[model samples]
Target: MPERGATGPRVLLRRLREVMAQPASAQVRLDRIVKIIAADMVAEVCSIYLKRQPQVLELFATEGLNPDAVHKTTMRVGEGLIGDIAANAAALNLADAQASPKFAYKPETGEDPYQSLMGVPILRDGRVLGVLAVQNQTRRHYTDEEVEALETVAMVVAEMVTGDLIDPASLSGEEGRIGPRLVKGLALCDGVAIGTAVLHEPRVEVHSLIAEDPEAERMRLLRAVDELRASLEELFARAELGAMKGEHREILETYLMFAEDKGWLRRMTEAVEQGLTAEAAAERVHNETRARMLRQTDPYLRERLHDLDDLTNRLLRKLVGEETAAVYALPDDAVVIARAMGPAELLDYPRDKLAGVVLEDGSPTAHVTILARALDIPMVGRVGEMADLLRTGDPVIVDGEAGEIHLRPAPDVLEAFRAKTKLRAQRRAAFARARTLPPVTRDGVRIALNMNAGLPFDLPHLAETNADGIGLFRTELQYMIGSEMPRLNAQSAFYREVLDTAGDKPVVFRTLDLGGDKLLPYGRQLHEDNPALGWRAIRMALDRPALLRYQIRALLEAAGGRALWLMFPMVADVTEFDAARALVDHELGRLDRFGKPRPADLKVGAMLEVPSLAMRIRAMAGRADFISVGSNDLLQFYFAADRGNPRLAGRYERLSPAALGLLRHIVTEAEAAGIPVSLCGEMAGRPLEAMALVALGFRALSMPAAAIGPVKLMVRSLTIATAERFILDRLTSPAATIRRELEEFAFHEGVIV
Candidate 1:
């Protein structure tokens, strides 16, 4: 084998450009290109296998082998060396190609004489377009230089395959064009939205692949790196961000570190030296990194891929002189698609025009999910690798309620969703009519329907839904959104604004439920194996008394001369509640010492999230004012399942007899001891779940604002006595869940659930 030099790839790329410039059929150009690759690399065979679909690769063109195999040979992804390259989006080099376990021989290809083979994936925007390979008869290893040269050539090949040179329609199979596809994911926010898909951060197309001046391209790459670094540094230098302390700060620091990474710079600089434009260098390097990271099983390492992708995108845009603007000329009804994004990024869109959001990766507890909930936008998450499957203007239906995404739906499917949307609008109007009605059932049992809130944005919904009060005020959101810890006055002012907006309506303030998934930007970072069960909520508060005291003082000051309702979350036993209550008492004492005004009335409660708390509820009632069943956490803890894990999402049934039994026990115990009990969790937001809870003796339900009206209508139509009797009969049943039964009952009884 001859020594492969640095200029070999450049020379090949120059010839390929000449072929692409000539007016010829795609087939003719591809045929000539393969011949050039075979001669330049001095290989026995050179083949180009284009991805016909997600799972299959077809031989498109070849040289130095049987021409009969050009359009006939095919292999499933991961079936052979070519397939392996496509599946993993990585290169393969072999001294003896036939010895590898992944080798798949095709008689038509007539390549049994080949001994060594080297292949590289033709990648664009982190997606595998095809595989480019060279085979040699002699048993020999491909050098690193040879591998780099092949990868560089493959990059140029990707441009040709995806560009006007090769029509995707011609390469595609009998499907003609991509058709309607339904993808399932997790519901982050519940609603339904019909819109066109729009990528949150669209990839900037690099038109100039080959560099006219390598030195100029190298300088351009360096300049973009410096600008990227300066921008991130300026962000960190802002007053609020400068004082940031914990997880959020750490994330930004990581972003900055990546922007200044020497290894990343070296890779892109080398790509430029290999004769690619600055933008192309960034694109190539990012594509390579993303492909390698996508195959990693380590979640932490895989997650960092998003950071790398974002940084590289910024650099690419800079190189192309594109402005870093958040706004886009989006369609009137646009659904944003992203791998993952922050709350601020979501807020950048024109909310009125933005209909929904779909994330390839996201969780219910993610800040963006919370923002989506507050803004009343439909959002579905964990839709794997959607960016590659979807186009910018494709019609999409975000069925967030069902956690389904319908991409380019057939006419009938689209019409059905349109009808569903119409019906949903009608239901909303009905809910609005029942907004001011009392939540009194036909059996004369009065239930309290309250809204759960956190941000000030949720305040208007209190009036819109006409909720009885704010049942669960998640205080952690204020801390989560800011870069630095909110000072006493700022916290106090925000709380005051909430109270003022509520007017006479009671608000239950749950003290900073910080740790766990709701970690603060300014708090100490904790790495926990099982964060849900680790030091969180009341546990973190008690351990850090000053943090609790600061928040308590703010709440106290904010509620001066008004009634104050506060709760301690994740209380395991009476002792924990007692300790947390003691902090509130201390804050009241401090107010008195400073001659400051105090709340006219104070009610301290325990949030029943831990299972052990149920056993101690009787004692808890004696000391606490009320008990709010944190059903979301309690049910997960009872079932010993992580709520965030998608695999376990359907494994545990929240409507199971055991779950209701436990909740029934808590309500019974709390009632016997003369303490008011309410449920404030995701379960309360669903009409069916709320109906079951009512049957189990829960009278107070706090849910998302959108749910109050529907739950209210259900309550007004239900007869508690009949519901109780029906539910009691099933409490001892062997059924895994009573969901179907409940739905049937609601339908027959006209319960509006």
Candidate 2:
């Protein structure tokens, strides 16, 4: 064995590589890799344990830790340090392995010389493949350099074992080493892409249990109970303040009651009294609760698992003993995999490094999906809980566009993906070149193209894609991203940057449209039978003039002589429109008084989301400078179907008769009043929907950046006159027949509907 420090890291790495380069089978290569590691680190023992099928780790090769135990030894994840490392895909650098409580001594191995150990799990694309370790007799701590060196060697070892490089057939398990790569799963989002499987960001939240000093534990439980009650009180207060709907407040209050359940608290107190640490006690109680609740066959009861997980993680953070299981030094081009994530938490990651998102748990309405679409990251959700199957860095293939995930994908799969990726790049090049070619209709009617934006991060995309300007800038995102209410100055800074990005081009900014399914930091949600119809958007803003004024002032200050378009959401009545406009005027007056710079022409608009707004379109058009239809919310509220509820989801269709009638009404009224109107929502993004809107007398559309290309494709393919005629015919016909007519039109026009 080489003396430690006698050889530099490079020389050591070279030696290790030289050893692995020997002509040998996978097992031989693994053995030599371990041997080189032991020699370079001057360790008395070396071992490598690869993860077996399912969940067990089988001992593969070893130098000093019991050669006889090879293939005979096995450990379940969390059984020992090896087990823990395997389960968590984390490195273990213990100075005194023998003294550690987690160390599982094996008498049958007949090896006890090692007192210290350093193990680095072999990870490929965020999944654990195996562990590489070197143990020394002396109780010594491994340096950071040693850990890094070991990790690098492990990575090379993984490449060798997987045969991803060298022998392609070895990895592909077939001759020629290439074939069609196709894997399918449930679709979370509707799209197709060929991107590498990036694991979702790791989310490890732990809830703390109260201390077990009988009395102290009791007090701790009491404190948690009190905190739960206080949260409910705050929720109720917000509801009363008109910031939250009554139903949302009720849900929160119910959650608080569940948190204080006598039986649940009793279990937690028992764990604490049993002398477990706060975190452990909490975990135990959490496990018990999950087990108890999971047995229930009721869907509603089963859904409480999500709530429990959220509550437990929060409590674990309070305990302060919780450690994130995996520590990923993410690569710039890597994909992220996780069970699930909130919108704010997803932003913690470096956006550029992110390629796509793979989740074991996620729904269409999940906030993460909303952010993902805005970021243009290909994402798949509800991946059936694959987090446990993954390590910190396991090689994976995720095709967000195809709604597929491949674990340890074969070599042929990789090759086919690479080829498809090249083709996608070529297509993107075509799309980029086409962007400058103009979005004129076949008969020469030009269409405006704009991008939907939410955050400052989305600003750069304006230049990247063929977008005319910012269309719908969701203002609520600012409040949603922060822990508390963002100050007016902070809001102004963001708004100013956005307007400056747009330059002379118009940027439409939406006011705070938070409530119902969305959350507010300070306001209490009011109790109502149905939240969607309750306090939200313009309703909340009208009741909270301070919030409305603050946002208006920020927008005005940011415009600074630029052409600015501001819009409010859920305007149901002419009175509501008047009130909202009044608030905007009031804020402008204040901004003038404060000497804040203002736009030379700031146009205030109202989003025609509420059905009532659709009914009073003429009145609204008469009062407003411009109007933009928020179709996503409009359709939801129009049909009385909860947007997020999948059960009632299919009941309301965007292309349905009822929705089309309402849209036509708004368009006819807006045209008669000569108020320029545009649809700026998901409906505008759908090619057929865009066509229908244009045909139905709507002249402008605003959609997501990606949808711009497809919609423009439609625009270039059909004459505006033809589209207008078809739309009029469809609208004039009975509601029951519009869907078929639209489909036929889409087919005849080759619009790829």
lDDT of 1 by residue, 1-753 (tens): 565544477788788889988899888888999999888888879999987776778899999789988778999989989999999898899999999998999988999899999999998878788899999989999989889988988988898878644445434333332789998999888889999999888767787888888998899889888988887677567675556443345445655666778999999989988888888888889899988987754344554576677788778778887854355577999999998775445655777899999999877656567657766899999987787677889999999888999999999999999999998999899998887789999989999999998876678888888899999999987777565799999999999999999999999999988766676545566678877789888888899899999999999999988999999999998888889888888888999999998899999998999999899877865689998999988999999988767699775688999998999998899889999999999899988999999999999999988788889989999989988999989999898899999999989888988
Off by over 4 Å in 2: 1-274, 277-337, 341-356, 362-377, 382-427, 594-597, 732-744
Per-candidate TM vs. native?
0.69, 0.56
What is candidate 1's CA lDDT for residue 299?
42
lDDT of each: 0.85, 0.68
Model 1 alpha-carbon miss at residue 649, Å: 4.5
Candidate 2: tens digits of C-alpha lDDT, residues 436-548:
77888788787788899886656777887768888799888677644478898888888888887877778899898887766653555456677677888888888888888
- On lDDT, the candidate that comes out on top is 1
Clashes of each: 0, 44
Report the C-alpha displacement of residue 226, candidate 1, in angstroms.
13
Q: Evaluated with TM-score, which candidate comes out highest? A: 1
